[model samples]
Target: MSAIQILDLSNNSLSGKIPTCMGSFSNLHVLDLQKNKLYGTIPGKFAKGSPLRTLNFNENELEGPIPRCLVNCTMLQVLDVGNNKVNDSFPCWLETLPELQVLVLHSNQFYSSVWVCSKTKHCFPKLKVFDLSNNRFGGPLPAWYFENLNAMKDVSEAGTELQYMGEGFHQDSITVTMKGFEFELVRIITAFTAIDFSNNYFYGEIPKVIGELDSLLYLNLSFNKVSSCIPSSLGNLSVLESLDLSSNKLVGKIPWQLTNLDFLGVLNLSENQLMGPIPRAPHFDTFGNTSYLGNLGLCRFPLSKECRSDETLQPPSKLEDDAKSSIGFGWKVVLIGYGCGMVFGLIMGYLVFSTGKPQWLIRIVEGEHRKKGRRPNKKRGGRRG
Candidate 1:
């Protein structure tokens, strides 16, 4: 297979270790072994200068530290190893890859302190899509992690006065097309990336700077120990499509400002200690019962139920009047009895009219009929005599 340019063994029953000799494919550009039963550590030398741009080994039982030799493959564009048993400190070596575009490391056993690139350092400079969700990484999110390429307007704006990497330093801009719509890629200047530190032991209020990333499309931080009022800054993500903050210790009413996010498609705030009427908005109207299922205090549209107004909660002026108007078991019984009596009376009247007739009425009608009959029976009797 040394002459093979692309080899795809994905979605097969292939088992055991990947052959170390397969790395001899010098012309290979894409190697896919996803959704297989392959087990054992990824061969370190498999990624060195093999022109491998896309390598996917997802949904396997591969374990141990990610092969550090992968860092040498500067031409690597997409690296997906999600849904595996790989355990390692954060792959800081990924920061050095200049052409790496998409990086997926979700659903693994990664545990580390906060990832912080110093203010002057360039980490994953060409990265367009990065997902590190469902891991055990903890600590406060570093500010310099997502350097906004768009924010660097000029040499002076970048604040290189502190430390210059030298002139002619330009960050390449990448364009991403998702859902058949083209979106100009903008780096995460603030904190809102598609980062999911959910289902872990993280705590503290969501940072206010998270809202500054206008390009963010997906954000999930549910199933954590986070508390405090949701920052109103979240409403600033105009491009945001999905936001999930469920099963947390968050408190207070949802910000009315969040209703302004017109493009938002999915919003989940369930199983939290939130209270107040659900905010009315076009986006809110689109959501169904699943969106707010676990929040007991949330009442209003989409839930198809409204909480009582202050005036409605007050007692009526007269208890007797209120009791009469209110529907109860006694009212139901009276209505049923009245209906039964009317039906029973109609049945009895019909039976009596059919079974009984007045003699005076019948005699008057028969007398008139006899006068018209004449004396026809007399002549017949004389002949018989």
Candidate 2:
């Protein structure tokens, strides 16, 4: 056992606490004990100058904080403690491991803010995958971590033989959420870059610097309290395939610039306060109403509501509509009365002229003529007398 370079006791029915002496091997390079029924805390000691490169304790019942002494394994490259009960803050000290590449602490009780050491000029310089989802971490999104991911920004070497993270007797696997679905990648490529900070309490706007990761393939910051408009600079990620910013407090129009992402296969901006017409593009047309649901202000194609043009008149408010209705009804009533009176007068004229002269009509005319003639005769006779 002392000369063994790899120890893989994973995917078994093994239970009970991990042996403290498991870390005593000086030449051990890989220690995998995932998918088991193990309980209790991890061993607190690792031999100095240990050659251990991979330590995987995924899908176990392990509790308590991670062993601080594991830092002794300066050559550690992969550390996965996902789907466990480990309760601790962000392990910023892991930044010291120069060879460390993959760090996954998902689905754990890990709480508090993720702090980055100010003095560490190059943190996780070679890291390719960083997942902290389903944890209790709360605070503003850590922009410093994104700023220091120098590895993610670099373009993979072209025309070279593709290399995987683990290519030996033991293969490495990780659960990645893509297009709102979880998939376990049985083999990880060296160029694969992803950052998942979902299902947390992170607030504030997404850092514009996130667009600098041109090599990123997947980026999920969903299910948080993130607010404000999404950075238009995100259009710079030409290679990003999956982008999820759902269930946030974000408010604003979807940046038309995002249509530039030709490679984007999955996009989720639902449950936000976005408004205005959804950007028009061939890529956007592929998405359905679910992508923009919960945003009542949003309108256009894919949604049933049509966007209003600037020249279109706005509908009247309730009070204004009621007043206009009352005024219109009053004018209609007056017009109806005038029309009825005119019709009755014309009917009386037709009876007198069209059907020969009527007695009542003739009598009214004769009486008016007699009164006028008598007035003139009376005046002349009085002057002669």
Candidate 3:
């Protein structure tokens, strides 16, 4: 009915195409048909000025491109069409929706690069959760889009009241891959933020701008063709919890700056061209050898590969070498002088004793006795008196 405001048929065995008329409702704020057997393209032609806020068609048998007509619903917030058969390019057009927050298009046939939309200055300004994994999206990481994720950069805590993300009537949720495990978050809080761009064809050096999102919680760029050294600027993410850059073409030593993230709990830099000793710290120490498994050049406690002494110790400078040589020569000279002194003393003693009381020794003793006789002991004189 047109009067219905919220329609939730998720996690059901409902089959057939989604009713086109449902998009016509003026008051419909939430439409959830996730985890269903629905088989058809999503209904296009959402009414202009429609108050629809949440549209979830995830894990369905849906096909065809995402309906562009739904852009008319200016008040839309959450759009999750993940784990479906939808085939389309990156939906850069959705940047028009100012109120859009969460966007999940993972496990879909979405292809092409997520190129910047020149028209929109502030794209997805309030987007907190962005999951585009398991798609055919290629090209370098979208630094343009990341630059405008103002919501993630600055999370507002204006109200003292705490609440999950959703219309008051229906609590919104989504499945996310975190720390190498799939987790179904039933209630997404306002502070929760994650960026999962893994399992894609994206290549090139990960943009350094990514470190600017200081408030980010989970970041996964794994299973891509991304190369280059991990940025040291990522240490700016003081509150970040999980970071996964595994199974990529990343090279160079793991940045020591990452050790500054005291809150980091999960770290996976495995299967890459990374070399050198892994950064050492109690936090990094907790991670097992598996974290640096595929990186043969990585060494330290987590890995059995010990760094060679030459690799760990620096070569001595010319000045240091000269100082060492001088010290060694000085010690050798002192030892030679000591040996000569000992030999001279021993030879003099043998000559004096072998003669069985030499005349020089007897004369010196007799002269000392005469001087002692002339100078009487003061204590002895006092006793006599």
Top TM-score hit: 3
**Residue pairs with clashing backbones, model 2:** none
Error of 2 at 149 (Å): 0.5
Better lDDT candidate (1, 2): 2
Q: What TM-scores do the predictions have?
A: 0.63, 0.78, 0.79
Candidate 2's TM-score reads 0.78
lDDT of 3 by residue, 1-385 (tens): 8799999999989999988898888899999999999998999869789999899998998999988887898888899999999999987888888898889999989998887457466888888899999999999876676788888888455345677887477899899997667889888887788999999999998888888997799999999999999988898898899999999999987887788799998888999999877777678688888788798887767677789775664334447889999999999999999999999999879988788777887899999988888967899999999
Point out where model 1 deviates above 4 Å. 46-50, 114-121, 147-194, 303-385
**Candidate 2 lDDT score at position 16:** 96
What clash pairs does model 3 have? none
TM-score of candidate 1 versus the correct structure, residues matched by position: 0.63
Candidate 2 residues 76-183, lDDT tens each?
Answer: 888999999999998878888888888999999999888645646688888888999999888886667688889889985535788778786557777787766779
Mark the regions of model 2 whose C-alpha exceeds 4 Å error after superposition: 311-385
Better of 1 and 3 by TM-score: 3
